[model samples]
Target: MMTTTSEIDSIKKYKTNELIDLLRKEDLELYTEDLEIIRKQKINGRDFLNKNKEEFRNIGFKLGPALRLKEFAEECKKRKKRFSSYKTKKEVVLTKFGIDNSIKNIPKFVPQTINISDDDDEFQYCIREIKRKMEIIGPARSSNEAVRCLYIETILVSAILIVKRIVREKIFLEPQREIVDEEATG
Candidate 1:
C-alpha cells in the first residue's frame, strides 16, 4: 500500500507526470518518503470502521452500519463470499440502486433487525417480509409474477367486499318488504 521513490522507474511517464503535477500543485516534492498509495481504497467520508459505535447508540441511525470491529469483520467475510460468487466484471456496481447489478456489493451480513416504533419503518419491513417469503423460493419465481399475484388478490378482495355489501342490503330490504306485506295482508 505504501509507495516509495524507488518505484518511480517502474511507473509509466504519463502517470508519473500526473502525480508530479498533483504534488507540485500541493507544493510537495515527488521524492518524498512515506508516500502511501492505498489500492482499492476509496477516500470517501463515509468510513463506517472509523465511526464510533456509541454514535449509533444515541443517534437515530438505522441498521448496524458496521461500526465495531467485530461487526466490520463479519461484514468483510460476507462481502468476500459475495465477491467470490459474482466474480465476473459485469457484476460489480458502485451504488445500491444506481445500476442493474447495484445490489451485488451489499454485504449481506445477517440482516439487521429493524425496530419499528413508528410508521416509517413499515415499507422496509414489508420488503424484508417479501425477502423472507421468497427466501425458500427458487429463482424460477419472477418478480412480475409476485406483483401480478398481489394485484389479483386485491381484485378478489374488492369483489368479495362488493358481494358482501349486496347480500347485506338484500337481507335488510327483505325484512322491510315482509313487514309491509304482512301489514297489507292484515
Candidate 2:
C-alpha cells in the first residue's frame, strides 16, 4: 500500500479527532466541503466505519471517494481487531525476551506504541539489541512462536526506520512550548 500518511491513530478506538485525521489523508481525495458535510451530519468515526457504500452515497459522497474511504476504514478496523486479539499475548512474549514497551506513540505497524525523539541515540542502540536477540529467535522450539517473534522484530525495525527518515526530513518536530521569562514574572 502507498503510505501517504502516518498511522499514528490507526488502531485506537476512533473519535472525532481520529475521524478528521482520517479524512485528512491525501489519498482520500475528500474536499474541505466534504469534511464540513461530515461534520454537519455528525458522522463520528464509528458511523464512518459502519456505513456501507449505499449509506455513504445517501450521505452525499461521490462514488470513487466513498469506495476509497470505506476501504481505508475497513483496513484500519482490521488492524485494530488484529492488535486487540493478541494484545496480552504479545506483551508476555516480548517480556519473555526482556523486551519492554519503552517505544510509544509511533503511528506505525507492530501494533504497539513507539515513541522516538530526534536526539534519542538510545533508541537506535535498543533497536540493535532487539535485532541481536532476534537471531536467537530462530532456534526456539515452537515454529509458530519463532515466526511471531521474527515478525514483531521486523515490524519494529521498519517502524524505527520510518521514524528515523521522518526525523531526518524534519517532518516530526517536537511540540514547541512557550518559554516564560522569570524576570518578567518577577
Candidate 3:
C-alpha cells in the first residue's frame, strides 16, 4: 500500500487529497541532502557492483522492469507477503546515510535465518558489510553505464518512498481542513 490514506484500508477515513497536500508541504530538502551525501560518500554503482555483484544477483529482481516499486509494494501488501526484503532495502538506505529510523515492532512478521543481537544496529552492520566487500575488490572492471543508471535510479526511488512515509507520519501537525476554512473566511 502507499501507506497514505487513499490506499490502505485501515486509514480509509482520511481524505487522500488532504494527505497528499500535507506531504507536498513537507521539508523535502532534508531527504534530498541525505541522498546527495550518500552519493558523495559511496563508491559509485559500477565499482560497488563489480566487487560484489554476486551478493545482489540472487536477489532475483529484474532490472529495468516496467512496473514501479510502489506498485510492487502495493502488491506485497495485498498478498501479505513477508516484508523482510522491503525492510532490508530500507535498512540499506538508512545505513548508507547513517540515519536512525527507530521504528520497531512492525506489524508483519517474517522468518529470518540470520541471528541478530538486540544490541546490534542492523543498519550500520549492513553498511559496514557492503563497504568491506567493496574494499576487497580483486581487480578493476569495466562499467556498464545504462545498467548503473538504472540501479542508481531504482535505489533512489525506493529511498523516496521511505522518505514520503516518514513525512506523512510527521505531517499531523498541520491544521485540519475545517480550521483552514475558518481562517480563510475570517
Candidate 4:
C-alpha cells in the first residue's frame, strides 16, 4: 500500500529513533498508531487492508519452513512409526526398515519420508525425504487415523499459505526505483 503524505507526517510526529525502537520492540501501541495514520491518509482501502492482512500473516509465515517437519512427524505417527534418532550412519539404515514398513502399510505415508535428510542441505530436504517415503507407502485410510492426518495437513497448508502471502507482499509492496540521468554530463 502506498504511504500518503499525511500518513508520513503523522509517522513523523514520533521521533525517528523512537519509531525505530518501537519497531524493534514490536510495540503494538505504535502499530495501532501507524494504522490510524494510514487510515487518515485515505490510502487505498483494499491495498491498506491487504497490506495489513499480509502483515498479520507474516507472523505465521515464518512457521512455513517448519511445517514440513511437522507433517513428516504426523505421517510417521499415522503409520505407527516413531520419529526417533538418526545421528549416526548406522541409525539411518536401521531406521529405514521401520520407515519402509510404515510406508508399506500406509502408502501416503511414504511420500512424507522424502521430507527427511542430512543436515548439510536445507532443512526442507529432510521434509522432502519424508514426503517421498509417504508416497511409496500408498494412501492412508479415511478413518480416525485419516482425520488426525487431515488435521496435521491443515496446519501444514496454513503454514504454506502464510509463506506465500509474505513472499507476495515482499515482492509487490517494495518501493519503486526512480530513474536517474547518469549518462548525461552533469
**Best candidate (score: lDDT):** 2
lDDT of each: 0.39, 0.63, 0.38, 0.41
CA shift of 98, model 3, Å: 30
- Candidate 4: which stretches are off by over 4 Å? 1-130, 133-137, 146-151, 154-186
Q: What is the lDDT of residue 80 in candidate 3?
A: 38
- The per-candidate count of clashes, in order, stands at 0, 5, 0, 34
C-alpha TM-score for every candidate: 0.15, 0.40, 0.16, 0.15
Candidate 3, superposed: residue stretches over 4 Å from native: 1-141, 169-186
List the lowest-lDDT window of 10 residues for candidate 3: 61-70
Instruction: State candidate 2's TM-score.
Output: 0.40
Q: What are the per-residue Cα lDDT tens digits for candidate 1 across 1-186?
A: 222233232222324334334333432232322122211232112232233545433343333331332254234445545555654455444433355565655566795453434343434444455565455553335675555554444445444444455457532112222323443531
lDDT for residue 111 in candidate 2, whole number 0-100: 50
Please give, for residues 4-23, the per-residue lDDT of candidate 3 as tens digits: 32333332233434333322
lDDT digits (tens) for residues 20-94 of candidate 2: 766786458788777776777878766777777788778888888678777877776676566556657667766
lDDT of 4 by residue, 48-116 (tens): 222334443343423432243234323333333221322456546546665543444433544322232
Query: What lDDT is reached at residue 137 by model 4?
Result: 45
- Number of the top TM-score candidate: 2
Better of 2 and 3 by lDDT: 2
